[model samples]
Target chain A: MAFRYPDGRKFEPKRNEMTKKSVNKDARFSNRGMTLEEDINETNEYYLAHQVAVIHKKPTPLQIVNVHYPSRSAAVVTEAYFQKPSTTDYNGVYKGRHIDFEAKETKNKLSFPFKNFHDHQVEHMKRVLDQGGIAFAILRFSYTDEVFLLEATHLIRFYEERDHTRKSMKKKDIEHFGYLIPLGFHPRIDYLKIVDKLITGS
Target chain B: MAFRYPDGRKFEPKRNEMTKKSVNKDARFSNRGMTLEEDINETNEYYLAHQVAVIHKKPTPLQIVNVHYPSRSAAVVTEAYFQKPSTTDYNGVYKGRHIDFEAKETKNKLSFPFKNFHDHQVEHMKRVLDQGGIAFAILRFSYTDEVFLLEATHLIRFYEERDHTRKSMKKKDIEHFGYLIPLGFHPRIDYLKIVDKLITGS
Candidate 1:
């Protein structure tokens, strides 16, 4: 079943919320079971609390068609359609630097699928880069428990080369081109550390 | 009846074909008699194409509960609920500065109602201003066909004073403190001009 909102629109607020609920206690107990999205959200909260940065995930857009007003104070969405997002998953500012990125998780144990990313996303990243903004992606190999912060420039290169080659990028490829992000407790995923490295290296 | 995605998932692919439907006889008719949301979307496209800025309305979050899969390829949403937004409606980058604003429309001919603005949104704008980002609200008086870009600082002042003084800001105060942005043909609402003025004034 699809989700409906207070205004009668169809869009799932959070795809992993129910699963998160189920494993919430277990996660709290074992310190193991946090989804990529949840961890990123938590990390963002931590960043905000520490006055470090202000990053946010763009919500999934929905085109509401039908609305049910049960009373003067209540408006429930009865019918709505989902809309495709044009930009990246997350964006914000960090110490005066504009930051933008998309997060993706793969179950692949050996290599990440190039097909996981859309062409428009690559184009968007390119535009962000051209306009002098930091653009990158956080890739998580779910099965292997590995996380890598791949710069948008490297992703763009792989994207450009895809027309010539139809194969997925090997683990070694990302390991060489991307910075390995060590997960911590406060900001569970410390992507800014890698960002600091990138800015300093440049 | 509520609309559902093909696969009964919460997400529906964007209707790319609908964009083709927008192109009409007159270049000014690009909005194509769509809803206010569609019109704003078209305006955002124009803004992006002209390299003016990258403003986008954040999507409404929905918490879907049940979905019915009528067929292998078709999904029908059965139940869901709306979630309160934590941030402003629109945010983007412009000329190396981060710009964040909310757009609101009112039918009242006298004054833009204070109820149109939310407490959290005002708080968000205050933080944005403190962080050195340009924050404001675009108020469209639909009855008079007039639009005004009011700075967040002005809004914060009015809002803070509301506890001891008047409940709402008069139209005259808005006219004095806000920049009147005449509705245009190409961008429909040329806010960049006001932004330029704000930057220059600072």
Candidate 2:
């Protein structure tokens, strides 16, 4: 005996049951526990649709091992592993300026850990700044729900100073050097307005 | 009895034999039949390593359906499908300017088909241009081994005129409107020289 819909379509009970449970769990998490990444992605989508800026978060790189190619359909990746990203998470054009940045979320109320960024990523940001592009990091305090856009110069300075003092940057230092991004209804995290001020020096 | 290497490692005969055959076949093709995409990727790698410029081809977007998470190792993608890219293949910062472009290779000797580009990609390129960022296309003739850097403005004009004329842009038209990129050893496709000309009008 198998389960069937009202329209008489056959349904696999086990798979559907598992899927329903997963969906409910995801809904619960998304409502009150949406990640910083998810919020930034939604903001980027709004920016694109409204023709505000052309920024995008690059897709996570994967090293695929085996792919199953079925007839008359798309190939299915059977085995794959996530590769460490070689560059920053986000980059694009904003007002003809090359904008590049990484987004990091910290649960600590007092400080953000320096270990959140890799050595290569810090070096990459240095190169972007050297080439005259605008580079920064969006640091999100998960507990406070506060987001700040910290310029690459300030980030690099703090990164280099990690060997001498604290292993993390204090919230007060971030407040001193970074611009706070206001959360809005449509765009969510409006970081571009901060960029505009940085460019104009106003 | 199982086959074993001199170093006491067991060798899987069937898998190794198949892998060796495939490697040989790929080597044969890569010698004289590598793709335009490969060349551009090699050039980008060279740019990054030498600290000349930072450019990267975005990874192919995939829609993951199922994942198997093992306790000891990284999560493996059990099922996934390729998704149509919403943006161009390549984009980066070059000399303080946002650079965005698509590379297309055609075997057709007479004309490059407009069908190589999707409507969304063309629209995206137009947006890049409107924001004063540098946008262009790298058109490569596979048979002739010729590559040209055509600016986005010219490409948009020809794309709009496609309904009134032939479905493809003629080689003569490409020659007239685009700058030919001379192939070199170190940097491979030296398209940046043409970008310099575009910027300074030299």
Candidate 3:
């Protein structure tokens, strides 16, 4: 059977398109244009290869309605639809603690809207936190090209306290509460550097 | 879109059919008849609700070949095929350590054939072990009604030591190397109790 991550294969041609300019250029110049999801996935692969962590992006949840067996060779999925994920986008083992996080990239200039996340994801994060797992969010501002790691506790607080006036997390607050992800070449966004700090409670 | 897990829904009717007989029955009788996958899913749900752990079964990996956007309601999957999983069946955090494992049930009383596991899953478990995460397999002997927790190291040894003669893991060898899971009413398989022991190194 064929194997492919939903968006993973879709990004390949685009990545290949960047080959000419990205090949010889420095790390930041080559990678700054990639999506946050791709960057994190590449980073996770690097960590896995290096034995640094076992983090993985969970597959997109789908509901298969009908399957047609054309022959013994293959069973084809004829009818299915996307299902909202019951948990965050990414999770895995990190330094003996359950590492869980949702990655979101926003085009808004001043703040990130609370609408970016679903209710179940917020609840899942809370449960993970209560279970003593490390929970957080990797947020990226598309226009400014800034990525920050915001701990779930702070995100939870903002979410719980949200009102019509306080609908989203402000950029200044994100800057104050979240750690900026150091972007580099090979692994791209090194969020684990921040995770190491989180592990040590520093 | 429906949020049903592949087998999760498939088993519901069978479980409903068992409600009358299983409702008043003892835990062992009630759960012993259930599939290992269902039991583990129910156990994980219990753990999550009680804040004991945040484990989850990874969804079956499928390669989507085509999608049909019929109106704005839902995008229907027109073509897809099941793919080999790149990791174990289940993983999560337990008492501050990463827990990763595969669960299998076999009708064979003599042994569990090594062919039950895919190459990628074994490699994934090894990587998890090297990264200091907990890795193991939960094997249930169906005919004899026995369950054992075999650590990845032992399983790895059995796998690597295999020749044409040693095609499978003998039940006797498994009983010697693996720990019997203490099953219970609410959780069905209390594998974490075994995990607690592993963490303490006692």
Best by TM-score: 3
lDDT of 2 by residue, B104-190 (tens): 888999799997787888888988887778999999998899999999999998998898467999999999999999987666787
Give the residue spans of candidate 2 off by over 4 A.
A1-31, B1-31, B163-165
**Interface Cα RMSD in Å, per prediction:** 9.5, 14.6, 9.0
Measured against the true structure, the TM-scores of the candidates, in listed sequence, are: 0.82, 0.84, 0.84
lDDT of 1 by residue, B1-202 (tens): 2223332322222232223443343644554333344455667789778766676777765665455555444344455455555678787777767778887766777776676666878987876776677889888777676778999999889887775446677888899999899776676778878999998888
Q: Number of backbone collisions per candidate, in order?
A: 22, 0, 0
- Sliding window of 10 residues with minimal summed lDDT for model 1 chain A: A4-13
Report the Cα lDDT for residue A83, model 2. 54
User: DockQ for all models, in order?
Assistant: 0.19, 0.27, 0.30
Q: Highest DockQ: which candidate?
A: 3
Ranking by lDDT: 3, 2, 1
Model 1 bad stretches (over 4 Å): A1-24, A28-30, A71-73, A163-167, A200-202, B1-39
Each candidate's lDDT (Cα)? 0.71, 0.76, 0.77
TM-score of chain B of 2: 0.83
Clashing pairs in 2: none
Q: Please state the Cα-based DockQ of model 3 relative to the true two-chain complex.
A: 0.30
